[model samples]
Target: MTDFQAIGASRKTANTMELIASAARRTVKAAIPAVPGGIIRTGRNAWRSGKASKVAFLVDGAAYFSALDQALRQARQTIWIVGWDFNPDIRLRPKQSSETLGELLLSLADENPALQIRILVWGMGPVYSGKSLRLFRESGFSSHPQITMRFDLRHPLRGCHHQKLVSIDDSLGLLGGIDLTARRWDEPDHRVSNPVRRSPDGTPYEPVHDMQSMVSGQAASLIGDVARRRWKKATGQKIEPSPVRDAAWPLAVAAEMTDATAAIALTEPGLIGKRGHYEAFRLTRDAIRAARKHIYIETQYLASFGVARELAKRLKEIEGPEIAVLVTKSSHGLIEKLTMGNNRDRLIRRLKRIDRYDRLRVMYAVVPDERGGEKEIVIHSKLMIVDDAFIRIGSSNLNNRSEGLDTECDLAIEAETEGHRQAITALRHRLIAEHLDAAPEDVRQMESEKRSLLETIEVLNCRERGLRHFAVDIAHGGTTPLPGTAIVDPRRPYWPLHRLRLRVGRLVSVFF
Candidate 1:
């Protein structure tokens, strides 16, 4: 036999062997459990399970606040808010309201003398930005005897309270990445330049996109418990649970799932003799590793080295789930550009090299310019949908801080039943449709015809609205961009001394 023929036969044999090995690896992953226990918990907190009578996904601040306004109007016994920052000057209902947040809360409290309103914000947040100080000075909650606001300062060094949650009457809960503050009040329309996207003083800012998950029933009560615990730690006073009333399910938000179970996961730093919890990290990692077909994720920060390593391992398999990550086009500020931007580049570069199946795609959604200037939208959502099996929505970004440094709360719903599966799938399609500027039904129909997600998006995307591939080549030891630019994005809870601390941390990491 000729040498060329022998080589051709040998190549065929190697290809067959590779196929068999890939199939075997998949079988092994499927058979073994990713998370040994059904629940993801840490030393401090246990995973709580409760039923959600109704779960609704609120896309952007406009939808979220509109629904929240209605719910707050119906708040009876108690109204609780926990956030990284609280701005009373920001209008909840921008079109209808002339009053600030403090006025609205005071009015409700005055009307119902028995109703109590409490707010807990991160202590150091106002010091980081002048906007937060304006919120502090302008939010007249102190004058009202019924309203109480406190700063949470019980975290380890460099950690901050980063959970955005609101629970009313222990019957309704709102949780996700959207904070009730300035620069987070845009609608899904996301016009290239909207007159409404401005601060109280009418200073315009770029359009931002974030998500919130609203729930009623036991799940709401569970989240309320979390808030109460936090308030106790910060205030040294325990608050009683509110009486459960008729679930204040928003009539405007169509219920996506009824009587569904929501898994509550938390991230808490170990401090002052209290154990730390990292359930948010564990839950996310397990979900991604268990995905069989597709894993869709939208996040603000992708700086977790552990998560990137896990994803790279999964991508190394010849055949596995297709990974699609939707991220903001750039870091928000100068410090973030140095820390998060550089870290993100390093992570994606590793993934790019390991993606052997051509199945990994990283992109950012853009609102295309009609007059020839594309407007970048900030993607501040922490969400993931795994093969129509489970969905996670919350304030936890995919970063080291969210994993262990900061405090976070996230909600996950597993599709154990047929109804749950359909709901999860529909939610995924709706989000993709929003990004592509197409109807959810169209995305569903195209996907049902066996088209890949990337293919469907490419076919539907036009010049007006679409997802643009985020180039990872720059991440591959390429020339980095200049830091400290106004156009680059900023960080949440921005640290003034980040540059100095970052240099110190890098030096420590090199030796440690």
Candidate 2:
């Protein structure tokens, strides 16, 4: 009961505290999934972990436009929209509201004097589009000085600024492949004969399917940061973030997950060289590589041999998971058809050869025509679902341009528990159901009954609003795109030919 006894007791307490700290560290390490390497990390995705108080996956233009309208109506301080394209005349909510996007923005600015609206759109060449200039001249967007718009031309030659994001009050954001433009508003029916599917000129466009996800809280702040950096880079003018306290989350759209972790990824010119930023590409590859049961992808183009190789490797595994890729039946124009279609065919053949176990299936979604025939529903959505554990939706396509040439942004969410996994699976089912024109519950039931995703799809497919198998004759050595076609669908900026001089320049570029 002297100094010696007291010293011994103090040492014992210290040892116990150290043990507790060590055990805590082990538990924390076990909670988070290990960062994957090899194929995924090799690409170097610019992945930054962020928090989302509320997250919702909105499918198709109907859901996206509706939710966006609701959020815009609630905006208090600022609104920021960054996209590959923008059509001011597009109706924000065709049925619920008669307001067009430009009109809505103007009205919001009028009502809220303190509100600032900034828009950044790609400076597409006339060969691709001149719609942005026409919109500014004809639409009422130019009438409002409070709303600032800029065309983003800051990119490598042949590259485009292809990220589509909308941030409201720096507390709510939406990001994905769907641009707020014309020919992007259709209900889940995806009815080929739908009257609302017509453009501003009353011309009917083909049916299309696309998706965008909304996030609130800290996640929105991170997206706002990205958008501001883009605005600065494109315009060389810095903008301040909004000071809104409450997020403008749409009341009508229910939150899919609360307190979830969301990762923001990017693809930029910086990622092309030795020291690069390839977060979007890396995250995508890693997610596919990490899949254990199934992989579902919806894309507009499939031209990247690197991505194709990764899939082929997985398909060649003895007990590999099933892979389902949904793409548009054909590209829009003749040149696009010749290039994108040819590339798609070549990749499918390569994957088919490695799919000795029949684990890979490729199909194009379709909508029913009024005359009892089926019409192609252009699938422009960039999405990937991996075994109910990971969900990625963004503007980046599974193509070489998106990987190295284009400026792109994407976001991903990884579920950590069984309940979360069920939510992810349900979201996938809902998307597939929308494409198939079947009930989400029905899709879930079919998938449960049949272990194979391809089998479930084969059984549930109907003549009306169904999927059509993609079959192409295996090319002798994979079809190479025609010569001048590269100028149209180039992996880099197209250089104009000036006889011998230009010919020499082109040759040098090809060799380099």
Candidate 3:
């Protein structure tokens, strides 16, 4: 089958316009030669992204918030922030700076005459009142002339703009799932109770694990382009890109890879007359198919039917890549429990049944709490590493909303040199080690001894406070999805009778 045919995206009675889009993508795919493995090219499955001169992976909130604080401190011409939410009261560097995010931005605006800061977020930002920033009403964003924050209202019903991006002076870019919000700060050690990990209100929250990346050069400018385009769409004002400047990447933080090819993949629901962008979904599917040795995925939600299908097919193969999937133990709230939680359970059960070769592992992490009981460290990161050759990180979850109903952006990197490959592998090992409470080198040694990631994890996992397989920890969500799953975790935009359509579509994807 042709590559596009191999894609064969599941659909529910696609309209003529969508059909035309598929056909057009097919034509484009036909003209361009199939991209070789490990190389990212603009075609059906990918978009054109700029090359990076330097890249660093920010593992936890400590690293992410610190790098972001330094980059924002260096902002000169322009700063663009886009995200699902932000909390102005959260300090980027709690010990180093006493200023809240709002205070810091205000201070920077007051200091620089040329710098203009713009923040764009989902219209429902206020609904997440306790978590997100009050930029509109109480926060000082409305008072400052140099800084403007706008809540984006342009989306299909129930859909949202959920991208986390920061661009400074068009010279540096920070992108990942880590948001500038309260209850989002935690160290790599993931100590259950750290005095510094409390929120602005001094309330302690759960241990959270997340990922972000800092980059410069053409890649940073391209990321700046992404932020500016969204700014114009949310507000009618056009913001021009600033000229690139010398970005002194923060000290003591090491670069993960230098001089690598990177690209941004987006997931945008079709709104108004615009075509939907599902490149993130397509890229995940293709990445799974292309994997030869191992596929490591860490996500907050694991409820995408499209991605489940891709992974199920791989698990059915006798010689497919060893897949290691890590997800949070439960949904955050009651509403999410019925929708995201139930869907995740059913998918996990189905995959476990198809693991004839025993190449699949679904797990979660836990740490010893101060009270001597184990506490589940929230796996808030959305990242994937395939065979040590490719790495992707961003706000895109493995849920239905992230596939097409919500706006998302993910940074994907293709390892270009020996150093890049080694770095990618080291990153995966380090992250896995965090869960195992073992050293990265120990994880690497275990992997080298056991050819299978499943076997490696089994050997290293401690029964008390490390990674636990889903079957041992989480109860099954039943063979069928719970009622109202489609309403809460929609895969497509709401149309007339969209609820009925979504229910029907779920039935089709799961049973067929």
TM-score top scorer: 3
- lDDT per residue for candidate 1 within 353-408, as digits (tens), equals 65545567777888876787677778999999988888899988987778877889
| Residue pairs whose backbone atoms clash in candidate 1 | 331-489, 332-489, 332-490, 333-489, 333-490
Q: Per-residue lDDT tens digits of candidate 2, residues 59-160?
A: 889899999998998988889999988888789778766778888989999998988899888767212654644755754676577888777766656677
Worst 10 residues of 1 by lDDT: 485-494
lDDT for model 2, on a 0 to 1 scale? Answer: 0.77
Q: Number of clashing residue pairs in every model?
A: 5, 7, 1
Model 2 is weakest, by summed lDDT over 10 consecutive residues, at: 493-502
TM-score for each of the candidates: 0.86, 0.85, 0.87
Ranking of models by TM-score: 3, 1, 2
Model 1: lDDT to the true structure: 0.77
Candidates 1 and 3 compared by TM-score, better number: 3
Clashing pairs in 2: 44-278, 45-278, 45-279, 46-279, 157-493, 158-493, 271-277
Best by lDDT: 3
| C-alpha RMSD in Å of predicted model 2 compared with the true structure | 14.6
Native-structure RMSD, model 1: 7.7
